[model samples]
Target chain A: MNESLFPAPAVALAQADVPVWEAVRFTAEGLVPAIAQQHDTGEVLMMAWMTRETLAETLTTGQACYWSRSRGKPWRKGETSGQRQRVLDVRLDCDGDTLLLLVDQDGAACHTGRRTCFYRAADASGTLATLTEPLVDPEVLYGPGGGHP
Target chain B: MNESLFPAPAVALAQADVPVWEAVRFTAEGLVPAIAQQHDTGEVLMMAWMTRETLAETLTTGQACYWSRSRGKPWRKGETSGQRQRVLDVRLDCDGDTLLLLVDQDGAACHTGRRTCFYRAADASGTLATLTEPLVDPEVLYGPGGGHP
Candidate 1:
């Protein structure tokens, strides 16, 4: 096992030696953040986190598989809503700390039935403004928008 | 005056002490990268670089601005196309090294007259796939899409 450099726990000294998964995984705080973008239009869809296992699923299946930090388990984008994001390219920056995923988004990426979750904007004064009108109704997208009240 | 960190012969660092640009600004090869996302859709439209002056303009004008490395000058997003991206929020990550600019993007964000710039995806097998189809014809968008061969 190789020694870690910075102030953090060493996950595996063999991480560099043997490649168990196709993706190069690194956990910043037990979770690796991923930035997902629309493959064709360069539109950033959303940002999520994934574990080594989830990353492997994306690489192997050509479909996005994320480990929901909130749910604490695996997640298939659009699995329930039919808005799955098909994997096109998985890229890592020079640092190998973050991931840039190119995907073919089947439908809206947001539970609100919009194309993405970031439908609001925050101004310098911290005022939140609605950015775009919904493309699809939330009632039609998610079973009551993920069953939220 | 505090000693300047970046080697910018073009920039004058006289007011170095009074709330000047961040130290990370100087370390960014004199050009900081900016991420643009569609405000309503939360789709990441594109990524471009910015100089300090342009960054200042964007904040002051409430518009999307970028530093064109090719032209070696400033560019206002959608200025010529009328597809301008109105700035909603500008954020610096925890490290303050990178920037995220959320904007209300009007019309298309790409010169090809497409809603976004990422139009293709490459898989693990190096196979490229088309993700999004163009909304507007490129001829009018680019003054011509590669022109009649």
Candidate 2:
């Protein structure tokens, strides 16, 4: 993880401003879809779900924290593979349901070791093609099973 | 709208390929979040929901179509405002629950007349700030109440 880019953790909310967490509209499952995008380049990296606790942690720590549906726990981005995303800004849509995270990504965002999880695209012919190649070996990131569920 | 950029409507899906819509995991509400990103720039413009029919329509028509929860109907992006999104490609996450639409967006993507619906960012101090100004007047697009529900 890029330590220098990390924002001060657990900073106090401004006294005059409303709490950020209040505006979020979590699903029935207490989860919200969070999309991570490169803060400067605007390249969307990956999307995952966030529970209230994880979202609060992400806001306080200024790092990406997700609620892993399969693992059934909090999964810190790059906690295992070092592809940490330093939070630059957090946004909620007008309806207050979805989240948009502008982050400074340290490395490849995909467990497949690609810069982005969305590296495949479907053409008009309905054929799926790889839009981007893996930047690092999967073995180097998650070891075996390629992080598959 | 860029007519030439539109892929042929209802182009044949390759026989060998599995139809993408089958893999999607809609929520209990029968909705899946579909994110629209600028194909070339990688800028995420908006996040909306899609039903199976809307998803199919988007694929066959090569345009962005969504399920408007408020209106309870299929909403063809730019159908009313002339801010259509021409689909360049489509993608599903590994779990096939969420959708990513890579498209060429025409005009503002937000009903508020902003390029993106997510125009507010919350800082560590809990202050909310406008990140982008509206590209056009909402009155010019949606008129009157500006589509606010």
Candidate 3:
């Protein structure tokens, strides 16, 4: 990935008295959507929700942290599955409601162990087709439950 | 830039009796977040909410349509600014909670007349810095009102 496209936010967040998280415009639910994309490949890995706390932590730590709405808790990437993302660049959209992260992915970003969560593509018949198979079994990633929460 | 990464959804949407929009899992608010990216460059254009009606219309017409939460109405991308997006590929994330749309953007994707909505990058101090300027003036894009709703 081109590091020059955007500066890494870790060093930046570390120095800022006024954190970048302050600029984010959270929704009524106090959440914003964050999209993580592979830095070099430009492959979008996943989309997740981030609260201000998670966003601040992510920027400061240079790791991906998100709010798991289903579990009602903070979800740290790679905490369970070891598929962590190293944040290379952080960006806010013009409206400040969305975030884009250029990341160095450790392994498959999907809980299914696929390279990306967006493996199902609309096919020539408007039917969703599975384009990629899981590289690692879910049981292998998340243990007994075999799925992420 | 490769079309082979995913098949174009336009031709596919035209043939299917069971529309792909049905596969989407909208949130409790009856909406799903749709991310538009440049099909060729992999540049993320914008993120917007989509209702079933907007999503269906988009899939069938091969154009981008969204629910304007602010306006509380259906928004055809080019309706106001002529910055339409011709959708090339449609993908659903593993959980069916998000959509990835690969599109050919007509002009600026942001109402600010930037090629993409994500133009501000977090700098070395966690402060956002504008990385790119608007290619077209906002007034030119949206008339005298000067800003999008």
Candidate 4:
């Protein structure tokens, strides 16, 4: 990956003077796990992979950007669907392998049009149950393709 | 990995009749990302990697178990640090590449003694700041060695 496309490392330094991307432990595919949470509600919206380029774009734009492993490209949140995640804060885990995004989410975060990706819960009987209903029709969000863009 | 140690696939099925671990997309190292969130507060406590064995252990034991990539072993929560995370619910992402753990966390979830692992946030100016303070001293939790057991 070309590091030149990203902002200067010094400009995006995190805590302890460590460069944000420098501290991340990306996988062999150059992807890191990022979790988006509702800043006020503490509700976890979704989890996605972010490449160095997407991470940089997120930092610069104050918007959530993720790496689409299948598409092999950067995906700006709400680019195809109107479910944008406006970043309120960005955090890296103590180990720096994971990321936390406190965001002001608009509309559904899941492709299924659910408010959050985690709509299922396992009960004491070890049976999984859907905990929520889709807030919007998924077809409306993804169009006739019925898949991510 | 030994599949025999895990419960029968029929007995550990999740929603849609999918076996709990069958649909998981483990990395080349046989590891998957797991996020621990507070069951009541919905606050994300920590993120870790879990191997098939650890994931099975967590399901059967109803506790959080993770694989320590550095130590190359399964580490049960609160084994040495007294920071146990009791599993309340477990969910898989639509892509089946990530796991969400709703847990009743005991004590601090962070090695730094913070309630959550993500205690720092970066602002629009790209400046990092601490969002929370340590709930306990690191020395008290890890003993004087200041390293994982």
Per-residue lDDT tens digits of candidate 2, residues A1-149?
Answer: 32222122344232324556777789888998999988766667788999989988998899999999999999999888878999877887777788899898987988888887766566665555555667899788888777642
Using DockQ, rank the candidates from best to worst. 3, 2, 4, 1
- The C-alpha TM-scores of every prediction are 0.48, 0.83, 0.88, 0.85
The digit string of per-residue lDDT tens for model 3 on A1-149 reads 35533344333323324446777889899999999988777788899999988887887899999999989999999998988899877888888899998889998899988989987777434677666778888788899776565
| Residue-by-residue lDDT tens digits, candidate 2, B27-127 | 88899888998776666788999998888888889998899999899999998788899987787665667788888999899889988887666777555
Candidates ranked by TM-score, best first? 3, 4, 2, 1
In model 3, the runs with Cα more than 4 Å from the true position are A1-19, A123-126, B1-19, B147-149
Q: Give candidate 4 misplaced runs (Cα > 4 Å).
A: A1-15, A123-126, B1-15
Clashing pairs in 3: A12-B124
Enumerate the chain B TM-scores of all models: 0.78, 0.86, 0.86, 0.87
- Report lDDT (Cα) of residue A67, candidate 2: 95
Q: Taking the tens digit of each residue's C-alpha lDDT, what string does model 1 give over B1-149?
A: 21221111232222223122453243335886667766555565666777878777887789888987667778887766677888766654323345567677887776666675544333454333344556777666556442110
Worst lDDT window (10 residues) for model 2 chain A? A1-10
- The i-RMS of every model, in angstroms, reads 15.4, 6.4, 5.6, 7.4
C-alpha lDDT of candidate 2 relative to the true structure: 0.77
The candidate with the higher DockQ, 1 or 3, is: 3
TM-score of 2: 0.83
- Extract clashing residue pairs from model 1: A40-B118, A40-B119, A41-B116, A41-B117, A41-B118, A42-B118, A43-B44, A44-B43, A44-B44
